[model samples]
Target: MSAELDPRLLTRAREVVSSITGFRDDAIANEAMERVVRGELARGRSSADLLGEMLFPQSTLSGTLVRAALVGETYFFRQPEHFRYLSQVGVPAALRRGSLALRGWSAGCATGEEAYSLAAALQASVPHGFPVEVLGTDLHEASLETARRASYGTWSRRESAPRLFPLYLDGVDRQVTILPVVRRITSFAQSNLLAPLPERFGRFDFIFCRNVLTYFSLSAREAAIALLARALNPGGLLFLGAVEADRVPAGMVREGTPELQTFRLLGPGESASPTPVPRFVERAAPPAPLIRRPMATPVPVRAQVTPPPPPARLHLEALERIEGGDVDGASAVLESLVRQAPDYLPGLLELALLRERSGAREAAVPLMRALRMRAERLPPDQLVDGPEALPARFYQASADAYLNLGALE
Candidate 1:
């Protein structure tokens, strides 16, 4: 591969790849296009033939370029909070609302892990024999095939991943297959966010499109969100990546006070209204009969008291700054958050990582030690009091690396 390109070709390459896969990384897009161009040239295809494909990026040849550029890196139970919320609140709430069957979609699902994880969680939460279906979609055919195989290596099982339910059958040679029960409820297919999801795939009770939209162009991202929102059942939940969390689609209400970055699609007659009343009345009530109705008691309107910002919100703000490449701003926010809530584990851990990243190893040591001490006092499985509610062992394991490295120094 030449790895060299004309400026015009590079610009056109980015547009074509972005149109096909919605990838925002120019370097990856350019590199992949160069490699594909070389292959096409070697295959005796003329430059004009390649230009035609660029004009129609949805063609099979263009899909090859997209597959080349995409990085399919995902693991089972990648973010546990979404799964935790599903089991604790989402599932129960759906049952309470009289949902007979549960359906879920994992948009941008790289492989079967997330889809299978969701299936396992739903199976555990719902009653026996209750219907459950989970669809995992990715643009890559190889990834979709791997998902269909339902087996993963040790790398897919990170320490941070929690076992919210039975996820695997058994391990052999460091690879495990997802349990048959879970696999039975889960399916994988190749699909693009830029296109409409098939109508045969009905509205879902919840959808996990986490960490996927970050690759899209701005307009495409908004369009994709609309599709995801539209795919949801009224009052359905949408889980997004932390970086993509703030971009709540229209007709959706962000849920929870923490930085879980989940949203709820408004059901029929549901309003993302400013008035936080118990329930919305359909229409104007008929005036009470003038003679017989007793005098109504006066209802007092209370002042809307704003609560102080939680450590989680501050932490999320800091994370957003970090993602925006504003390291100094993120550090300042984390510092202020720590002063306000010194016991906040996630903040302390994040600050320590930032410090370590900035080559201030000594500054990071105490933060690591403090977090480790707090984690040790709790049972290993006990969830720390924080935004994601990750277990104590997770913090301990995270802190151990820094603490051990410091000791080595």
Candidate 2:
């Protein structure tokens, strides 16, 4: 088998993928393409024959390439604040329209976490027996099968609150499954975002397409947004990733704070309105002291008591526990250290990875964000003092976390 892939073969693979999925060549890295080429060669297929299958409109090879190249990384309650707003604001608004039925769509719903999250939110918001329907669509059949199963591991629950686990999920032997109530309202299907959505899918009152458009080419992004806008009911809401807020299409007005990353479709004869600024209640300052207390005569101060050990010590202790395979104990110690020093890079990265493994990736975001902010403020030379400091490793870990969460550009 040839280790070298022909440039023409790579170009053909890219074109086939782009035409089918609207992903650019750069979006699917060369490494992934090489893997596909090598796999075909290992199976005794020549490069020319593999290319022919890829270029064929209905060939299974094209679908295989799409699945292999496009990664689906999602967890439950990813960006919980989005679900909070959906429950508090979006659901209420849709219910207010006096329609007996409420419909929501999770486009590009990888493995059904986001779709199930939306269903859970709506279930919590609406009264019993209210007609609520949630549709989750993705391009990969394998992911759709996973969505249908509704069973997930710690990786899926990392960001999910413990309380929510008992409320909405059934956990047994380290696998947590979405409950029947959530599954009842949600359905999954194989569909491509670049292609025309099925007519039976119908219009939706709310649509979630987060962290997906960033992978698309500009023209593909525009086309997908247009299709989404057309699929939305008048005054319906669309939730996008924060990074994509600026690219919302015409006839749709951004709603809520920029942080919410929500957009609403404007009906005929309607004009876009500025999102209302949130009003925070100001707590009154405690009543001023009647008078400034005069300084007391200082007695000889007692020798200062010894201070507690620094967070770095606790971090080191946690590392020992982790090395010893007491992950739970190590996590407990790391959690305490981070609470005391949220910006401690070493502990922060360790804890974030722990949270990720435990199915709480969303919970890890702020810690990673803090680390990123700190790294950005300081130069490499100023980032560390010793091997244990590991500032460069910290920065790299932060970058990796952001990439995992789809927060990095």
Candidate 3:
């Protein structure tokens, strides 16, 4: 757009755009880059001058365009329904029959928001915690660094609804930080959804390759879909962004409202060949109950409390603390136990239940609901009623939260 525009810079812009998105329109690419730099710098004359120097002065922009393009906006709970379906339907169906270890991949996971979001959703659904894991991969190493830092602006907070707002801690600068509970279950790495997935990456129970496929050409899209399909463990579910769904296989079923298409991988001894879409079969007999009564509350330790009980006998003390309204102290013990012994499903359930009792109901609800759903999804050979049950309080509070949001349907 300038009389003295550097042809070299224009070429660099086109190359950057094409490499990042596989789009080859040189003129459109330069126009977009100019617009991005100009828009970001337009706040003041000084900022405008700074951007002009950064973009126009140099023949090659220093990773600036890629950073700008990938510093996308996202929030803690950006897509509520997708998560709900994950909790109550998708995950459970996947894990129903066995003591299956589940893995989830968030391809093109920009800045870690989506991966952390999946971690939160997974924990909510698999209370008393099943064997589950999450992996977040983005092509940009720098973007992965920002995600590793795990901080975001008020702009990111826009994705959370008021009902769930209290669940996140807002920083002094109005940035939001994901709670420690959500961070424990996920890890991030640099990955490109195209090309061979890294040797270390393996089949997963769920894959979320969202909002990215639209950028690829038809051939690239199909190859990526095939690659993703191969990456899924049979019976795994794949979730796509709303716009990217059509690029996935035509035989896959697309469900849920405002759908980001969700597909299920065929189990072993099965094939990916299209099957007549199955009807919603009524569930078999209900599984056994999780708990018979309110669990014992945890207690606090005091120097004066005398002869600290043996670790095994410490349960009563911890129980007493919860009974005496020291839910936070009780939670501390359960959390420590879960960390020391990740296989301790009971500890996870107790912590989840105590969280609900402590009025963190919105956070607790997903744990119980997700647990039930995942338990149901286990393969028939490995099936068992999950080791934990939700306290009535959790469901009641969740029901209220849903009603408040008019999400009761």
Candidate 4:
């Protein structure tokens, strides 16, 4: 299969992919082209015809090439912190301005997990009777079809909190279907991030383009960000994946802790703008307090006491148990460590991995869910007095676990 195609033909295919999808990775573009070539040859079609089809606008082959070049890795509540910020920060600000109507856009919303997740978060956080609308846009029509179906296997729900399942899904046999309430507020459409947004797709108060920008070329990423910026209302919040923190555009101001990867569009007078003024004239108010829950009763001061051994020690002990083939013991140690320090990212991750390896993936679900919840409340700079204490590193570790376990792509 590899011997038949000319080198120049493959190079032409690669160039066409970059020009169409704006994917900059040479290796990925090459791989996708090779696969397309092989598949076309297998079907007794000429490489020239395949390339011509792919170059055609919105061709099925073109969509296939783009989908191959990009990953649609997503799950319900994959990044809980962003939803937390939306609920605890973005929503209340809008409500306070006497606007009960809220609009949100989930750009690159793979199969609608993110769009449904956002709707669920709003339903759970906001008071009843508050109106909300969510639009999910992606480049692939097949993904949109699945999004419209709203049924998922258990793997898609791996990162979903147990409490959220009952609130948003109905399970029958192996399939979990999204409830009407969540589905009613959300819609999906096919859209390319590099292209201009549809005029009917109005500006939104919140735009979520998490984990999608890193796949594009630098110029393409800038164009996508600019398009997202144009879609945002004045002072609207734009949430990117933590990995995309470095790629934020010029007209936006980073908001929340640095780890959060949330940005706010600066108002017209607040900053220089190369783009036109936002469509919505209403500006966001000063940020409301992040901690919305009431504080517990204050306790009297007590004498200083010795602190327990650091989480690192327990983590090592757990590792020793795994080495000794005592998986139960290791699990017990990790469970205790996480209980002692609920925000101990490493402990939570190790425990979840252990459960997954032991053929008890369900047992790991709650732990992973808990870790995601705690991760939301933690500051990005927050560190534990133990191994792998860097919050960003911990997040990377968590992401790795999710990918390895098939919770993410």
Candidate 5:
């Protein structure tokens, strides 16, 4: 806390912020609030003086706080993979769906960088004569103005950022302008993600709403995601941040691998949502698991690749990745999780099976041994803690089969 910061003023600011942003953490939301308070105080505005003024939703004070709170640093092509996927996978699929034109959105576009980036990607990827449009939106008015200008300072250009396509014009002092071509296809607006985009905005082929949700409360995040999903056309894709993949959107099926964190709205003739992965739960054993590996010759032991549910978030994420076929990525997650919480039963079991599957049965032995040791100490009927709440024996049987160590008599 800054010694000069006033607690009463901070409290008032927090209330206004919570009412508006639904930000999950006060400290993060407080960042802009503290600055606003400091600025007001330096200008001879007392804490009472500021509080005395109307700070309602439409008040000047409230607007100032929101602009400050929403201002975030961004650069061109921040996450290139989304662009690559858009150009390659997304474009063709939408084309196949017979999209007359492609629509894209950069939700919570902090500055014009992402919006312009989307414009460039769509312009380059979409076929000629098709109308392509991108709408970049944020609550920060000044940032939107900067985006509308379509000019950027050097800060917007990070050396490591991938330029999958040309973004800006090559100029000197007056240089660094977004190509007139890109500017033509892109537009910026000051808009709130918490609210539904107007009907005029129309449904989109894909939407990129990354990282911004990290600032939102649980309910707010869900609302924002649902709104974004609704904005997508049937077969349209919604792209979220990598860390934001934990919550699968309602009625949307997971697309690509866990790495992609993309979801597709069910198109015509597509099966309805059966996103069975993220909602790890305790359920009766399915008639068949995901994969049943070869049994040990003598006793014909079987190892089920699908996880028994009721796992921690980390484990669920790994399982989701595995379900998406990112084996190495899942292994990395499981290894770290098991190492940190060595006694975590689901981690031990799932990671062991992965290690065994990857031809590292040598490494798998110790994990299997550790898993068996742990599960044996627990009563077979006692369910382990996880979304699925599978019994200890479920893990023990898996471990025993991998080790070819025959189940306990």
Candidate 6:
């Protein structure tokens, strides 16, 4: 139809479409906006009504445009290799190092597909007895709600490894529900990376901040990365999107075989606890206590919390497996850690690297992406360089790996 809409209205519509979708093309954005406007008109809504319904939540006329802008498209296991790496290398290393009590943050988790995938993988990989805690955060309340519910459709499963499906999800009526086993180990919460983290959540060993960084401007990306660096522990690993990984600041190790790029968290002198403090209490005002105890009731006090015993020996065993070339056996241990504590980024990074080496690239990408997304909000000082850079021999090996993957193209 001939143009009849107000010039300002058309401009607002185009801007909303572009901002939401991260599409810079004016023509395509305009077309998308036109379609939306036409659909609203067909539903017998006035221009103002369409604008109100679609855009007007954040502010009045101007704010509504921003509200209407949202880009949401995702699926479970969208990137497979990243998960493989987590299962094989990252998880095992974290477990061996006795970082079972891990804090995992899924930054901009979207609809929670990746977070759920992590939970499922850990559940399938862990040995008979261990506990794991996982938490996912998203800025969009709607996305957080979807993640909390943990429900998906057939499309979410389209790219999932068929063999692992039964181990993770309950597929019914074309809808896949996260199994109870997965849910028991994972939880979802809402958060914004731009602000200070919620008091309830602290430093995390593993952080998944994938794909989301590409959507932000460079300044925001840098700020987010700095925050993520701070959020991680020394030697804690970071995963990133394939495209985003190279963009990460120097100081963090950026090496993985095929599907993943991992940034290593340097340790204190190569031999220190992954989590230096076992029971770190946040700085806050003390809670009010009861002044009088009833005859049957005793005054409440903080429980005595003990740190778990170190797993240095288990870590040695993992190294033995690596030396013996029993990568799968090593992976078994790593998977256990992920199952018991999937938030440990170092373990996830190690596992992702192993998977890439073992030709499981399809399974490593997600872990890398997840880590990348999480690292975006970490503190920048975490990227400080260590004295030892990669050896010359390792660079040669890396070149060969790149050539094998046809990445030179």
Best by TM-score: 2
The residue pairs in collision within model 2 are 154-359, 157-359, 158-359, 158-360, 159-359, 159-360, 159-361
Against the true structure, candidate 4 has what lDDT? Answer: 0.70
Better of 2 and 4 by lDDT: 2
Stretch of 10 with least lDDT, candidate 1: 275-284
lDDT (tens digit, per residue) of candidate 6 on 299-399 = 45786655532343333354456544466677776666545544444444556666665667666656655444443343311321111121222222222
Model 3 per-residue lDDT tens digits across residues 117-195: 7776776677566776789888677778888787877645442222232234667867777777666667898766666
| Count of steric clashes across candidates, in order | 0, 7, 26, 0, 9, 56
Which lDDT tens digits does candidate 5 get at residues 210-255?
A: 8676556566777888989989999899998643445468878886
Candidate 5 clashes between residue pairs 3 or more apart in a chain or in different chains? 281-387, 281-388, 282-388, 309-388, 310-386, 310-387, 310-388, 311-386, 311-387
> Could you tell me the C-alpha RMSD of candidate 1 in Å?
17.5
Ranking by TM-score: 2, 1, 5, 4, 3, 6
At residue 144, give the lDDT of candidate 2.
90
Writing each residue's lDDT as its tens digit, candidate 4 over 276-313 gives 32223122443344466775865557956567667888
Model 3: C-alpha RMSD to truth?
18.4
Q: What is each predicted model's overall lDDT from 0 to 1? A: 0.74, 0.71, 0.56, 0.70, 0.74, 0.54
**Candidate scoring better on lDDT of 5 and 6:** 5
Return the top candidate by lDDT: 1
CA-RMSD of model 6: 22.0
> TM-scores across all candidates?
0.67, 0.69, 0.55, 0.65, 0.66, 0.54
Which sections of candidate 1 miss by over 4 Å?
1-6, 25-28, 273-409
Candidate 4 Cα errors over 4 Å, as ranges:
27-29, 159-167, 271-409
Q: RMSD for all candidates, in order, please.
A: 17.5, 10.7, 18.4, 14.3, 14.3, 22.0
Worst 10 residues of 4 by lDDT: 275-284
Model 5: per-residue Cα lDDT at residue 30: 52
Which residue runs does candidate 3 get wrong by more than 4 Å? Answer: 6-12, 24-29, 32-65, 68-71, 159-167, 247-258, 271-409
Better of 1 and 6 by TM-score: 1
